[model samples]
Target: MTSCFNEMYLQGAVRPPYARLEGWTRAMPAELRQMKQAEAEALFRRIGITFAVYGEGGDPDRLIPFDMFPRVFSHAEWTRLERGIKQRAQALNAFLVDVYGRGEIVRAGRIPARLVYQNAAYEKSVVGFVPPKGVYSHIVGVDLVRTGPDEFFVLEDNCRTPSGVSYMLENREIMMRMFPDLFRENRILPIDSYSERLRRTLASVAPAKCDREPTVVILTPGHFNSAYYEHSFLADLMGVELVEGQDLFVEGEYVYMRTTEGPRRVDVIYRRLDDAYLDPLCFRPDSMLGVAGLMDVYRSGGVSICSAPGAGVADDKAVYTYVPEMIRFYLGEEPILNNVPTWQCGRDDECRYVLEHLAELVVKEVHGSGGYGMLVGPKSSAAEVEMFRARIKANPGNYIAQPTLALSTTPTFVADGIAPRHVDLRPYCLVGESIDLVPGGLTRVALTDGSLVVNSSQGGGVKDTWVLAE
Candidate 1:
């Protein structure tokens, strides 16, 4: 088995980024650590910062575990990551506009035509219509995993409604509240401005019809949805209305929000729901979670959507393999961050190779999220492998396989004491008239010993990410 890279320690000495944290961890007593952990959990519960797992019988709302140990990065490291993230965001938005308009990348033989037009997430309704600012995906959540000090690979992209930024902000808030001296000691960058930046990004894409300061509202799929807390949290932070489909209605050309004062015009909608649930008239007619004729209003330039209607195609796992090519084709630049080596099961040779090496590779559904519908090969039993093999053979195009990467680890507070656990980073990059992201991102840690998965639904925990100032 390959050894994982430890982010905090190297050769019995602490890494530069984590030098300050070493003494902090060593000085904390076990009883005090336990008390702080309990206090953190209570705060999370009180704040209602919880998520629900679908098809589960347990409590509908569960608090994601919070690790007190923070993951740190130096200024130089973060500068490189920021550039890569912004570059990827630009390429993704450019790809969305290209694929929906002239299909230039497809016509130029840079990417497969079938992959763009035939995918399930592709919407034909907005083919010729260009969104405001030509930005389809306003918030790009790029999941990154590190294999070594200088090797960071984008695991996947979430161009649609990506959840977890609320956790990123809340984690830092809790940490600052608990350890006041730590904040004074370490010049960690501030991420509190994320909400304001997000609001500005959304407003920057308001439709041309709006001549005044645009009113932006977050469209949520009701409280039953898993990310309901995030929807309300962001609304409160940004001072915008968090409304469900029922709270909105479509007029002749524009959409309006129902308020006690009157029917107020909504200019920009930061929708947190999927495409199929955005407009009942255009998609999924039975969907009560979307407004009727909302698509028409959006297409007619009455209101703008944060991530335009057909943005999902750019984030498909199959399409992810072509992102580097997209950077070259669209931006005429090399990809700053690389993609993990992938094998598309839709191809005959790749499918055969994946079937033969099912136990050595990690396989995931092309559209899967929240850590579901995946097989961690090394951790699975023979029966599990056979089951996945049969599923893959039945539908080859639905799967993609990649080598099980040795994900880097950070110091995490465990049952016995501090230990190294596998971790991953998901930085939410905002795009509008420009592209930018906060210094740090949400760092998820696998709480179980030697586990590679770092999803909250999969028993993983989150840690406050620190990008120290220069």
Candidate 2:
């Protein structure tokens, strides 16, 4: 009915990649489906895989719905995505290294100076320092949306310690557990190597002072943070210790993790905490979530941060529009992927256009995440649009606007039957000595019949993403 591409269907014919699923979806019984859904929920509950949603009434910790249907991508399609992801990661890191150390891109006038140096996410503490291996965002989660058969646009880039890989891995694990026969029948590429790849990427970015095999640890903001489960999950998968700020201390010039075997010198940290709470001495003096002088040790090259501090500057939504330019400027190549045509509300003309078309645009805060501080104009009421217009007028620089994308849909199971729901893909590209990722990624689905939001915080669900073998 909609113009958006139905990934599973085209002109009443099943797409080649999804041909085998035609019978699978048809043959699966509703009674068995209901039972399996309950079983999956129990499996997730038993595994303790849940996320915390802030500013919500009642129980904040909730399980993200998991769709039994797997999202499939062909090997060729995945290959294109993999290349684009790596290219984008390399360009963004190069931009970070340049922005922190030099003003080359700014001098070239490729991107506005205020967008970087004046941005809240930019850290003055890391202005002249570069992380080991010149990697700013060690893990890049590039969010992609499809509108047509061959048209995939990158919605945005997650440069600073992107989460949800745990979901990607867990989705596959649960799928195998729930439907082993399906996996056996399909020649899906394996994503089990992600944790091992992550471990290697962390170790590969060890500081110059680390002479021995790097002792990598995941630094979490205790058990109360939203992504605490992912922090512990990745740590467990990587066979590393998960420590809080209290467990890590800076001594002399190096960071040491408190262990049962006494203080173990930490060479690398896969930090899940934010930059503001990373070091109380350097950023927020009143913060209790960070080490006293960890930044000092980090700047002194004692240990490496997986995503170096100040990496969020590159992740800013205002700076996102210049990513293709960053690719051309830094990588000396055109962007392999396309960015959705975005309107920076900071610009007078763009702001005017966005204000005039508030009813049809999707406006989001430049620094907002987790599906908060966003307006989906088409789905919003007139009152909501008016409220958003006033908010944008008051602080135009805080927002960016883009046309509502006709996000592609896939066959998803529901209480009634199989239906089409909007979905998005977040491919995690690990950057360190080299850029690599498992073929599949976290395929987030807006489970509601006509919704477009795919963030779990907005009532979205996860599905196993299967990148079929060649």
Candidate 3:
């Protein structure tokens, strides 16, 4: 494998963005570092900031490992990233509105009709209805990976309810508490307004029927869900009610939350549940996690759903290959950020190439997330490679392949001392009245030696990301 780019050091010298951190890491003794690490863990545990990993034994509510070292970005670097992210978000929303309404991009042959109309995530029920502000995906989480100083590629786009913003906020909070001097020394941008920004974004899309201050509620599956803590945490931060299906009901023309002081009208719903489990009467009759007839109210402009139902189709892995085309067709502009070159297994030629090079490429399921159902070919054994090969051959349309990228590395604190670890970033972009994102994002680091995956569910840890102010 080729040597990856080191974000902190270049040509044996500390990079400008990370220069200040060099002395800070060098000054801390091993004993003091260990003590601070323990304190951070204790604080996370005491605050109930834990996540559940499905199908895992022993302690389902596991605390995700938190690394003390932070990932830093220069102001100029962040500016470029921010522009690209916002552009992508706008194009995605435009595509969603067009596909559900007129299918302009599809008609123009910029993207395949089958990829859009026949997608499993495409909701036929939402066919001609446009959400308020024409924004189907209110929040967009674009996963990015860096390979060189000026080379960055989008790994994937999360148009549905994206988890990990809680981690972003918590990581910063803990870092500020543990190293107050770092904040005093550096002009790092503040991300404390993220919750308020999110709240305002949700409220901005209130349906036309709402005349008063729109009531926004976060609709969660339940406490047993893996991201339950995040659901509750966001609710607390935004000062909104976090409710389940049982706590809400659809009345004559609107949905209402059952409160102690009678049922309160809800105008905007920031749902954390999947589309199928959002409305039993519309998608799945057996789904008890959603309110019945809620889709009716949503479609009738009585209420609004952030990331409207059908938004997932825009982020489908197979359809992802056409996002750049969507940008050109919808926004008439070139994509600011490039997508990692992807080969769809659904195509016969691509399938043959992937089969022949199973040991040299990464294969992933079209709908998989949390780093599951993926094969990192460079790090896998022969048996694992053959297994994935067989699976891809059996069902080609269920997968896509990409070359194993030499993901960039950042300074990380390990048991021995400071070292470099592969890392990725997921910045949350909000799209409502306007598209915007905070300066920093959640930086997931691969904790295992020579590993590339950085998902919390896959034993990877997180670090606070910093963007220095100009």
Using Cα atoms with residue i matched to residue i, what is each candidate's TM-score against the true structure?
A: 0.99, 0.99, 0.99
Summarize candidate 2's per-residue lDDT along 1-470 as a digit string, tens digits.
38889999999998888988888877889998999999999999999999776777567679989999999999998899899999999999999999998879999999999898899988888889989989999999999999988899999999987889999999999999888988888999999999999999999999999999999999998898889999999989999999999999989999998989999999999999889999988988988888889998999999898788899998889999999999999989989899999999999999999999988999999999988999999999999999999999999999999999999999899889999999999999999999888899999999988999999888899999999999
Shift in Å, residue 283, candidate 2: 0.7
How good is model 3 by TM-score? 0.99
Q: List the residue pairs that clash in candidate 3.
A: none
Model 3: worst 10 consecutive residues (lDDT sum): 51-60
- Computed on alpha carbons, the lDDT of every model, listed in order, comes to 0.94, 0.92, 0.93
**Per-prediction RMSD in angstroms?**
0.9, 0.9, 0.8
Question: lDDT per residue, candidate 1, 1-470, as tens digits?
Answer: 23788998777788899988878988999999999999999999999999787666598798889999999999999999999999999999999999999999999999999999999999999999889999999999999999888899999999998899999999999999999899998999999999999999999999999999999999999888889999999999999999999999998889999999999999999999899999989999999999899999999899998789999999999999999999999899999999999999999999999999999899999999888999999999999999999999999999999999999999899999988899999999999988879999999999999888999888899999999999
Q: lDDT tens digits, residues 1-470, model 3?
A: 23899999898999999989999988999999999999999989988998787667778799999999999999999999999999899998999999999998888888889888889999999999999999999999999999999999999999999899999999999999989999999999999999999999999999999999999999999999999999999999999999999999999999999999999999999999999999988988999999999999999999999889999998999988988888888788998899999999999999999999888899999999999999999899999998998899899999999999999999898999888899999999999998879999999999998999998888999999999999
lDDT of 2 at 188: 93
- Give the runs in model 2 whose Cα sits over 4 Å from its true position: none
Q: What 10-residue stretch in candidate 1 is worst by lDDT?
A: 1-10
